[model samples]
Target chain A: MDRMLSADEIVRGLLAKEFSAAEVFRSSLERVRRMDPALSAMLSVTEEAGMAAARAVDECVARGEDPGPLAGVPVVLKDNMCYRAAPTTCGSRMLERWTPPYDAAVVTALEGAGAVILGKTNMDEFAMGGSTEYSAFGPASNPWDPDRVPGGSSGGSAVAVAAGYVPVALGSDTGGSIRQPASYCGVYGMKPTYGLVSRRGLVAFASSLDQIGPFARTAADLARMLSVIAAPDPGDGTSSRRARPEYGAAVASASLKGRKIAVVRELAGMKASLSPDVEGTLARVLDLCRREGAEIVEVSLPRSLEFGLPCYYILAPAEASSNLARFDGVRYGFSRKERTLKALYERTRGEGFGPEVKRRILTGTYVLSSGYYDAYYLTAQKVRQLMKEEFRKAFASCDLIALPTAPTPAFRKGELVDDPIQMYLADIFTLPVNLAGLPALSLNGGFTADARPLPVGVQLIAPQWGEEGLLSAAAVLERHLGPASVAPMAAVKGGDGR
Target chain B: MTVSERDVRHVAELARLHVEDDEIVGLVGHFTGIMAHFNALARAGEEGRLPLDDLSPVVFAHDEIPPLRADEVVESSVGRAVLDAAPDAREGFFVVPRIMEGDE
Candidate 1:
């Protein structure tokens, strides 16, 4: 039920008339049907919409017209991204019944570029948790091993790419939602600089930090996806108007000559234990960079790593408290009727939101409340400024910063769900990148020595608006290691339809 | 616990979420555990790991703001589209529980 082809190869075949768009999409669609029962990567499949889109691409090709750059590629959207007519529940009971009236800017751009929309994938409800285990739909399993989790809130998107169900999927990273999952699932995930990609219709978790980016098997495919969606939109006031870069051009030959890559001296002392395999993978990547003529420097980011998790927990939830105030049940999503308006809100929110989301919202309310605001919220905001300045100083000496995407590889599904602090601690490396509004990419680092191949990802963070450089460096690594391969899902793929 | 069960109830009330009696115990433990992490940030400041004397809070980075357009009126069908999803709407207004007290 599986067909092996790179996303780039699929586009090449379509353009060269070697195959129809329908043929390529059918392979993925059939694979999803056969394998999704075990993986639960997607929430809904837009089969009819996909067929119509595939046929349009065929028509464009037959009529001697140029299909846009992403022509005929099947991609998944994280459930929070709006697609008109599809139920964008954000894997929350709150939005379970609501269909967005319009498409997200990224969705419109994907459709405009002739990319086939596969379906929406599961996520932590309202993008609130690190594990997709918080998803109301059910957790998305790691394709590498079903008993383990695909690290999330964009876990399903990462799994969709890792399992070869689709070539590319879009994920939003607010404190490493995209990159951590990508690292765990062993695929390429990018959290573009804040304001680089339009977040017009993405359900806002933390308005300031949330950024939509791509997940792919190859650096080239990621570049292709980035090129299409990372354009300014009038709808998103924060979307940058900076001149666009040719992201694909940098991927072919990324010479790291004379590049000073900083390995954070501070994270070396982080209390969380790194698995042996991940430590080896990080060392391998640094060695490759050294061989490629890049100078590795040890840089200090005092107070940044130590305080980032707490600061993020403070700020993301604070913004989420205000932003999520819109979902009062009267406007669109699930609501209840009561004698008074307050009771309606109380019951609806109580019934609809999952535990993690409740914790965040409650914690957010606590921090932003009267006297405690100064201690928690005010202090976090000031520290956030210090963190930004810290990154600026670090970047003054290094072209890019490198770290492990997460402390460990994909873990067992139920392991950290009940342990909120432990779950938040796992996001240590990825959070500071978002806090500084810099661009970071997670690509295949290496694998564990176990019988099953567990993928580890190395992250390279570039200064704000430095995605091109990040991609170039990742391209160099990709060339050395080869692209991260598809997760071997033979057991699940060939399992009896249960 | 830094935040007690009573505090959890007050905060939940502020956030407009109705917590059942059974959830209070778990919520208290969760908040205390997370608050311990938040305290680390406080200690970082108090211990001078980094100076936090009077640095102005940065809501967003200064250089990253997008250019704003003139506030000219633009027509859109968004009003109709937005109203389409309301739980109950009549003549473009959302119908909700009665606002005035004693109206029930």
Candidate 2:
């Protein structure tokens, strides 16, 4: 009944008959009820459905059948992911009451692996912003400091794992949504290689950049979730058909010895931009790598470091504008009454979308418009091509690349919410990987020296389809840095709910 | 790098999202600031700073094109579910505003 036990540990305990899956699920549900009031992490909690799933696992165990790899572990999904049992709000009022008739591919995979569906977690509206403050329902608080913001658009999913409501949760990262929040909330999160996991039912943000990943407190739990969800789905044409190795087994035997980890020389020039805690954490992580016999080398990524942010802002919004056009108040989401179709479309969108969403859509329309297409959108794409080539060359000299997940740790809520450009700068470190479609992990490198000790994440980037190596290195770091810890506030705040 | 209110309104119209007259000035400022950041890419391209030769836009994650599945129709019971989710539907069809005034 320990809420803090990892998904792998819970599976082992269930197998050993130490506790029924039903007991473990109820404990997690109870924890969510207790902790989520202050965290504001969950948009909705599916008690009946989750309990039914748990009992099904117990029945399998009673009948002498294997209950599957995840076996009775409770987990949550970012609301951007569709689930038939709960409404997929995507943290936007536009789709506030809309229920998807199908489950996301990851949802189906998790359920098939016997992971209980705890319900949908909150996110930035349509996953547009770096802070969850853009969520129409209100921002999810960072568990480390209630006054601070959890780095987002997957803020709620990160908080769920950090507060120990669940061992793992699925989050989709377009531009560091998963990894940045994982860093702020002090947990391990991975954005798998693009196309490795199916995007069958994930609400599209930026099609080429969006990827589904996991947040967990331990490397093994992250690996277990990845192994369960990473597979070829015929339903998703973009899903990779490349053979995937068993990630759980890969991490179990992982070693850091003889691996060459690269430190970007371009990042050194921007040292002034990094907060002291993040800079110190990155240095300490390199030191840990050296001590473990992994060689740390320097690589230059001039184009990527210089132009990644602008390139991503242009390209992601362009795709998002096209993807979100389907929500024009006619089919399944919010709609308005109008005499003319055009007026209905305009009124519905203008009223339904929040400020950030409208801003991006407008920006997207401008960039792709008649006068500016070549100068902005096409130029950004060419820059992206150069960035990809730069990464390809860097990977030739090194096994993996290292960087800070964000420029700083968690900032106070409302600090950057008003400044769109400043808020976009927060993702400077994490954008290049997504542009190149590479896999990356954010591990809690260390905490800031503040009274509350906000977490700073050290990011490790792997080459395409290099999750095996990425998870292995993360496992080694977990041993040296100590595993991710739940925020202390999860136990103290929100007690009024209980 | 300056976005006039006219340009903001034009873009909003193209995007099919109505913008209030009050919000146009703020949106113009947002666009100006965003465009200022994007100028770095344009300058880099114009100056030939990064090697932009013979490179194509990466539309897919991988270099190889994704394999296509067999294009065949399959029966599904999702018709009822789809209808149930629609804001306005009748007799298995979506309801919409009148497209033609005199034809009906």
Candidate 3:
């Protein structure tokens, strides 16, 4: 079995009687067992449950019943996304043993489509940090190089797809968690417009900015998974009531013959100190788009230059502070016995959360506290609104905005762990899209000469509710980029073919 | 301005987190640097605007639920597992320290 096969390939193969769903699943399980030890991508493996589900799919196919769109396809859920049988730890020891009584809305959707649940992938604790280094379980290593960090919070999901462990996996993007890892892992990851996917069972990081998206090797597979998962949910109030479009069909027919693409002029030169490899790859992607008949325009988004991160720091943590307060050891998650109620709450939280999560919670609480609300949280909200308006104007002039996903490629592990500011700055190019609740995608553009596969992703931001257009453009770009080889970790480990 | 250790401790208490005394110094330095980033927002005028306080409502409005028939509501067998994992529990209720005198 090849390390990477698209979801469509797996489904078609299962239907054609070439192999049973159990066989495909065994291969995936074997791959994860071999690769994940080195990659540290998965937090928990649902081997027994996954095999049972795969057998059920095979039985359905045997009876001549259709097993939905993604029938027999195995996918991993980010640990933050709740699954019935899997522990949704959210990469923190606070809820290390917490299991959801019910499946998250996305899990239900994927299950309904006959997708097999592989297991839970790792992430940063409470999705707070940019690198998976903040995970209490331990950092998820980049598939390209074991020594480097996987761009995070959704790093495991990205690495799972990159290493060919799973063709597609679910990831939640709050301030570029999905896109950054996708860029780092050299795969396609999309952060759909906020509220496009339901957030009912997701452990909330930042309620307003968080959205469930998927990572895959191809645009078509991402689109297919998106179509299955993106729909309004009665359980979530913020979920969009808009009708889900045929994303896969849209991708199949996407053409860039007359499309107008814009490169954010301000963001282009903003990271002037980027490594020569990354800069060269980005330039080549621009040239490829121009060659493919896209009319490129230069535009300015000055408001996003400084205000995005500050606004995010205030808004996300403030929301997170409130959302995470429910885990005080009373109703669910970690707890400690104490003589006083206040002490119980304090000790439970202190013992539960990791260092990064605690830092953000404290920052959030401080900003939202009485004396600082007006000076910090309130002002940040206003600036967020301004940034949204600026994006609205920028989109009017161009069909999509393009920029590098990260200022630099994946850095060595522990490189930015000490310097919190440097780590936060890594999301500079990708956060503005989330702040505006716009749909954006990261695709493998080009690579560095070191054969290290420096992934340069051009982000395409569309107006809210314009995921169809954004995806169509991404499909065109993916096709033009050609099929890039994924360097699977299993192969690097010198594992013999199973 | 340098954030004092007192401020860090105060923030940690408000956040409902316990921090060691030695860690307070590092946290103070981190918060001081983070607050400097907030300085940019000071220039933006936000006098009368409300913060995102209304983002989370105490209760969601919904249609009245019909009474469940005994057969319609299946009690989960996993309830035992859940309670078993609880750090503090007594009988069916999650055990908590006595809030009122003589409650225990």
Q: Please list the residue runs of candidate 2 whose C-alpha ends up more than 4 Å from where it truly belongs after superposition.
A: A490-498, B102-104
Weakest 10 consecutive residues of candidate 3 chain B by summed lDDT? B57-66
Error of 3 at B27 (Å): 0.7
Sorted by TM-score (best first), the order is: 2, 1, 3
* Best first by DockQ, ranked: 1, 2, 3
Ranked by TM-score, the better of candidates 2 and 3 is: 2
Assess the local accuracy of residue B92 in candidate 3 as a C-alpha lDDT between 0 and 100: 83
RMSD of each: 1.8, 1.8, 4.6
Whole-model Cα lDDT per candidate? 0.89, 0.90, 0.82
Which 10 consecutive positions of candidate 1 chain A have the poorest summed lDDT?
Answer: A489-498
lDDT value, candidate 3, whole model: 0.82
Residue pairs in steric clash, candidate 3?
none
Top candidate (TM-score): 2
Q: Candidate 2: lDDT of A86?
A: 90
* lDDT per residue (tens digit) for residues A378-475 in model 2: 89888888888889999999999999999999999989998888999999888999999999999999988887788899999999999988899998
**Candidate 3: where is the Cα deviation over 4 Å?**
A490-498, B44-85, B102-104
